[model samples]
Target: MAYGYTGWGWPTGLRNGMGDAGLALGIIALVLFIAFPLAMILGVLALIFGGIGHARARRGEAGNRGQALAGMICGGVGLVLATLVLVLVVSTGDEEPNGRMDEGGYSATSVR
Candidate 1:
C-alpha cells in the first residue's frame, strides 16, 4: 500500500483563527455601536484583531481576507459613530444651565 501526502498544509489553522475572531469582533462591535461606551471598546478590539487577520491573510496564511477587511472597516465605522454620539450627547447636555431641559422651559434639576 502507498501512503498519501496528507501530512501538512502550507497554511495552518492559526491564521484562520485570528481572522475568524476579527470578523466576529467586528460584527459585534457594529451591532453594539449604538451604545457609545461599549462601541469604543469593541471597535478598538475589532480594529486590532482585524489588522492582525488582514496581515495574516495578505501573507497567504488565512483564506478569509475579505472578512478581515470587513471587520476592520466595521470597527472604524463603529468608532466614528460612537464618537459622534458622544459629541452630540455632550453638546446637547451642555446647552442648558442644568443637565437638560424638560418639555417645559424648566431645567432638569429644577424639575426634580
Candidate 2:
C-alpha cells in the first residue's frame, strides 16, 4: 500500500498494478483497437512498465510478472502490425495521370 520505497511495504500490490498497465498498453497499441499514437505510446509504455512490473513482481509483486509478460507480447505484436500497416499504406500508392488507380483501368478520354 505504499507509493514509493517506504522502507518496508508491499511490493506485490505495486507489481500487480504495473503488470495490468502493461497488458492494457499492449492491447491498446494495435490497429482499430485504441488510437493512432495512443496505442503506440501505450504499447511502448506497457513494455517498459511491464518489465519493471515483472521485476517488482519477482520481488513479491502479486501479479506483476504476468502483466509484464503480457505487455511484452502485446507491444511486440502491436509494433509489428503497426509497422506492416504503415508500410502497406505508404508503399501502396500514387495516383495515375487520369486520377484513377493504376490497375490498368482507363477512361473514355483514352478511347478517343
Candidate 3:
C-alpha cells in the first residue's frame, strides 16, 4: 500500500494558497494601513477608496491590478509625508529643561 501511494512527488507547496485575489487584497490592506496613518489628512481619501477597491477586486467586481497599484502609490505618498512631518518636528522641537531657571537676576559673580 505504501509503495503504490507514491503521490508525494507532486508540486503542491510551490503554489500559493489564496492565489491572486489574496495577494491583491493583502497588498492593498498593508499599503493603505501604512500610508493613510502616515499621510494624516492627505491620504485619507486614498486609503478609504483603496480599501474599497481592494474589497471589490477580491469580490471579482473590480480589477486587482489597478487596486494594488493605487494602494502602493497612496501608501508610499503617505509614508513620505509622515516621515517629513516627523523630521520637521524633531528638527524644530526643543529639549525639555532638566533644571529650573532662576527668576531672580542673580549674576554669576565669583563668591569668596
Candidate 4:
C-alpha cells in the first residue's frame, strides 16, 4: 500500500523482468545471427541479464531461473555462431574474386 511497494513487500518483479528481457533478447539474437554485429550485441546483453536474473533466482529473490538459464544458453550459442560467421566472412573476403592474388598483393585483374 506504499509507493513502489507490492503485496509481497519489496517488489521482486525486477529480477523476473530481467529474465524475460534476457530470454527475448537471446531468441532475437539467435534469429538474427546472420547480422553478426547485432547478434553479438544482443547476445552479450542477453548473457548479462540472464546471469543476473539467474543469480537472483538462486538466492530466492526471483522465480524465473529456468527462463534465465535458457536465455544464457541461447545467448552463448548465438554469440559463438555470430563470431564464426564474422570470421568466415572476413576470411573469405580477403581472397581475390578469381581465387588468386598477384605478387604485388593485388588481384591479377586489378593490376592493370
In order, the Cα lDDT scores of the candidates are 0.81, 0.70, 0.50, 0.88
Report the Cα lDDT for residue 10, model 2: 55
Backbone-clash count (model 1) = 0
Q: Give the better candidate number (2 or 4) by TM-score.
A: 4
Best candidate, lDDT: 4
How many residue pairs of model 4 clash at the backbone?
0
TM-score of each predicted structure versus truth = 0.69, 0.61, 0.37, 0.76
Task: Name the best candidate (by TM-score).
Answer: 4
User: How do all the candidates rank in terms of TM-score, highest first?
Assistant: 4, 1, 2, 3
Off by over 4 Å in 4: 1-15, 102-112
**Residue runs of model 2 more than 4 Å from their true location after superposition:** 1-15, 31-36, 95-112
* Candidate 2 residue-wise lDDT, 1-112, digit = tens: 4565657655444437777887887877854332445655666777887787788788774665776888878877887676666666566666565766675576767786
- Reference-based TM-score, model 1: 0.69
Task: Give each prediction's root-mean-square deviation over alpha carbons.
Answer: 6.0, 8.0, 10.8, 5.9
**Cα distance off (Å), candidate 2, residue 75:** 1.6
Tens digits of per-residue lDDT for model 3, 1-112: 5556666586533222223433443344345443434355444444555566566667766555464446546554665666666676666555335545543655568435
lDDT of 1 by residue, 1-112 (tens): 5977776668544456676777787788788877999988888988998898889889987778888889899888888888889898877874556755545666668865
